[model samples]
Target: MSRSTCVPTSEPALVVAVDGPSGSGKSSVSRAVARRFGLRYLDTGAMYRALTWWCLEQGVDLTDPAAVVDAMDAMPLEMGTDPAAPSVRVGSVDVGQAIRQTRVSEQVSAVATNLQVRARMRDLQRRLIHEASEGIVAEGRDITTVVAPDADVRVLLTATELTRLQRRALELHGHAEESAVAATRDQVVRRDRDDSTVSQFVTAADGVRTIDSSSMTFEQVVDALTELVGSRTGRVPRAGSA
Candidate 1:
């Protein structure tokens, strides 16, 4: 594994980067890890969803990279850390509910695929991490590879396609019909392809751990990650220090 960029400390905050495909349990695992250590948690995917909602509202062309970049720069983003009820804000407006709509979900990947948009978002992500005095557990597709490659602990979660699909379906429930689920599946597959083709998607690092969650309960995954963090730090994480 590549040398970790994480600086050691006597009472250091745990910086965890959790990466995985959609419905692979990144959110749940990341939240649990943060709660276990009392660290703040970030759902990076919400950033993209917020951006997508803004672009649609402004009628920006998703296919136009330059336009999307302009919108990204102009939009204001506010992220919250309350695990029980996290939120995202754009400008003076709160679009938390709007960003999760079926329309936004369908279009977010297109906007996310824009290289310039990703660059801008990456900058924002880095800023959030740097500003965190107490450490953070950030979960997203690119965190382990691009956003926080040098994080003290990098974990990649994976599960079978059927398991992922079922989990996603349950999340959608009445909001998405069969066609929407199919479209989401297609979008996920394409995103996977794009991420794999992107040179920076996965960093070759010695300490990066990959876990298959097909048969593991959420608690089991959390316990495993807790051990990884404990081994690296040589001590149990301090309360609220994840």
Candidate 2:
């Protein structure tokens, strides 16, 4: 938690790559860290979800990898990088919220697990990262390994299974009651299990920092990442500011 003495007076290009399992708060924490450092944010998972939503809309068979790849090639997707209000748009339709639907959650893993789909996404993600003006915080299952292995900072944020289930249940159902948690099992557990087939997110790879956030509040996790970023990049803010 100590600040670097060589902290730079002004911000520099810094790409922070974070990967984690479902409900591990990767997206939210990454966004918070990006906002703290005046950086862009990228939710790589949203790309997959957007693709899934598009595939479903186009009636592309999820089980057919070739068909899904065709759909992926034809899909027109746009991603907004602002951490404060990031968005996903497919063609003229805004799917920022639609991609988070239960139906999409249930099938996104199918598309994500496709090797061709992952390859295409990796290329696109790398392009976005390279084009980020001020730098970016990109989070997803394989970001730390595949998408941005050379990111300035890499973190694997994770939590206990019970905690992950409760958190996801709260997000999806507005409550973490037993019933809600039970209902969310498939979305958190099953989706993660399926997606893991293509990405290694359950554990941190070499040189990546591991942050077990089950006991940390959202603000605490954000602070931890922000501090890590400052330490790694020496791009610290003035004392007492951000």
Candidate 3:
């Protein structure tokens, strides 16, 4: 796509794009940054996961790009941000719980790989960014590269493979069988490979800041990101307000 194809926004609204593999702490850090700045918090991965859940509910063929494309046009997705309680809706039904299932997690990558699916999803993401007033903290694999290439601050958060796997295991706790954690880890790695390979998505460049979360606490990550935002914008973000 040409650079001119990207939508331009009026005024510098401090768009922050956070990209990382699953369990790398992108979601937690993005939420913290949004809370600190009072910016709109958008979890783009949840959008894809919601679509995955919807497709499964509708019995769409996961491998068929055409069917996935058709379903994409028909699904209605709504996201709510409470910071304290975030949720996602598909149609009029709340599917926040469904989106996090192992089934959806296993299928989301296959569904997300369809070019038509990505295009449709990207359009929705652009609308979310456009509609935001103060600013937005958008987190996803392609946010810094495709969705918001010109974001004021782009962060690529990463952690050691073992650390990520441990974190995922903790999150799953009683939700997933203990024996399935390794399989889930493999799935996440495979999905990351597929997304980066097929989509040609790059998270960070020479100037983009990369944060290693392997040795950092959640609070430390937030503090570093807040400082980065301040350094870039020339103003410290007002904790709990933008």
| TM-score against truth, every candidate | 0.85, 0.93, 0.88
Overall lDDT per candidate, in order of appearance: 0.78, 0.92, 0.81
lDDT of 2: 0.92
lDDT of 1 by residue, 217-236 (tens): 88898888888888877657
How far residue 105's Cα lies from its native spot in candidate 1, in Å, is 1.5
The digit string of per-residue lDDT tens for model 2 on 1-242 reads: 99768856744578999999999999999988888877899999999999999999999999999999999999999999999899999999999999999899999999999999999999999999989978999999999999999999999999999999999999989999999999999899998888888899998999999999999999899889989998998876435434
Q: What is the clash tally of candidate 2?
A: 0
Query: lDDT by residue for model 3 over 1-242, one digit each (tens)?
Result: 65656688655667898888878899988988888877788898899888889899999998999998888789988887655467899889999888888898888888878888898888889888878877889988888878888888988888877777777877876434556567667666777877776453344565678888899988898889889988987756674452
In angstroms, the error of model 1 at 167 is 0.7
Rank by TM-score, highest first: 2, 3, 1
For candidate 3, the per-residue lDDT at 153 reads: 90
